[model samples]
Target: MKQFTYVITDEAGIHARPAGLLVKEAAKFASSTTIAKGAKKGDLKRIFGVMALGVKKGEEITVTCEGADEDAAAAALEAFFKANL
Candidate 1:
């Protein structure tokens, strides 16, 4: 498994559009993906799970990848966060 934390820079945080986009990006990977904020954790591939986390601006979230393609998934997602989050 590979994981890293990101502090949301978007004023709107992970709202609907971004959440949907995130789900799509995560789905492109073979690795299982998950995101966590404090005690709350959600599957990154599931839109509702991501939205339900209630992540806010400047909040730290840990994105985790596990499975065969975890390394590539982690690298791609890191870039995704830089570009989108």
Candidate 2:
């Protein structure tokens, strides 16, 4: 498994558009991806799950990836967050 912690930078937070983009990115990997915030953890490939995290700007979150291609998934997700929050 691979994990990365990131602070959301988007002013609007992880709203519908960003969440959808995240889900779309997660779907490209063979590994299972999850986004966690506080006590909540949800599948990264699911839009609702991503939105349900209620991730706000400047909030820290951890993204974990497991199974084959986890490294790539983690890297991609980290890059996505860095670029899009």
Clashes of each: 0, 0
lDDT of 1 by residue, 1-85 (tens): 9999999998999999999999999999999999999999999999999999999899999999999999999998888888988
Residue 63 CA error for candidate 2 (Å)?
0.1
Q: Candidate 1: lDDT over CA atoms?
A: 0.94
Q: 31-70, model 2: which lDDT tens digit per residue?
A: 9999999899999999999999899999999999998999
lDDT for 58 (candidate 1):
94
Question: Residue pairs in steric clash, candidate 1?
Answer: none
Best by lDDT: 1
Q: State each model's C-alpha RMSD to the native.
A: 0.6, 0.6
Candidate 1 RMSD computed on C-alpha atoms after optimal superposition onto the true structure = 0.6
- Model 1 scores a TM of 0.97
How much is the lDDT of residue 30 in candidate 2?
Answer: 91
In Å, residue 41's CA in model 1 sits off its true spot by 0.3
